[model samples]
Target: MEEFEIDPQDLLLENALRVVFKAAEMLDAEALTPSQLKDLSGALRDATEIVLSIETACGCDHDHGDEEAE
Candidate 1:
C-alpha cells in the first residue's frame, strides 16, 4: 500500500473546481438569452460564496454553510 499526504483544502478546492466546470458546460457554445445568462451568473456567484466561506473561516474543519457565521 502507498500513502500520500493529502490536504483537506486541496480536496475542497478540487471539488469546487469540478462543480464550476460542470456548471460552465451548461453555457458551452450555446446561445443563451439574457435571462439564462443572468441565472447562470447568479449560480456561479453562489458557488463562489460557498467556496470562499472556507477562507472566511481560515480553513477550519467546521462547515460554514447555510447557517450564520459564528
Candidate 2:
C-alpha cells in the first residue's frame, strides 16, 4: 500500500469535524436534564457556520511568497 499525505486545510477540516462530534458526545455525557437540547444543537450549528466562514474567507488567491520588488 502507498502512504497517503494530507494538506493542512484537510487536517484543519478533519479536526473541526472531530471537535463537533466530540462536543455532541460531551453534551450527551453531561446529561443536562433541565437544559434544553436547543443550546447544544445551537453550539454545533455555530461551529459548522464558523467552518463554512473559514472556507469562504480562505478561498482566495493569496500568495505565500514575498512580493517581488517594484
Candidate 3:
C-alpha cells in the first residue's frame, strides 16, 4: 500500500467526527446508515492504529495512556 501524508490535525478532526457519529447512533439507531457506520468504524480503527501519533504530537513521555495513574 502506498503511504500518503495527512496533517495530524486533520486526522484528529476526522477521528473526532467519527466518534461523534458513533455516539449519535447510540442516541438514535438510524442516525447513520449501515454503510456510513461501517466506514466510520474503519476510520476510527485506522486512527487508533497510529500507535505513536498522540505521544509524538503532544511530545509526551507516555505510551498512549498505558502509564496512566490509577
Using TM-score as the measure, the top candidate is 1
Provide the lDDT at 33 for model 2: 50
Stretches of candidate 3 above 4 Å error?
Answer: 1-30, 52-70
TM-scores vs. true structure, each candidate:
0.52, 0.45, 0.37
Error of 1 at 39 (Å): 0.6
* lDDT by residue (tens digit), candidate 1, 10-43: 7777777776897778878688899988887877
Q: For model 3, what is the alpha-carbon lDDT of residue 27?
A: 45
lDDT of 3 at 28: 79
lDDT value, residue 24 of candidate 3 = 62
Write the residue-wise lDDT of candidate 3 on 34-63 in tens digits: 887687677667656553465557665656
lDDT (C-alpha, whole model) for all candidates: 0.75, 0.70, 0.65
The collision pairs in model 1 are: none
What tens digits encode model 2's per-residue C-alpha lDDT throughout 4-50?
88877776677678868887787778776545566667767877876
Note the residue pairs that clash in candidate 2: none
Give Cα distance to truth, residue 58, candidate 1, Å. 3.3
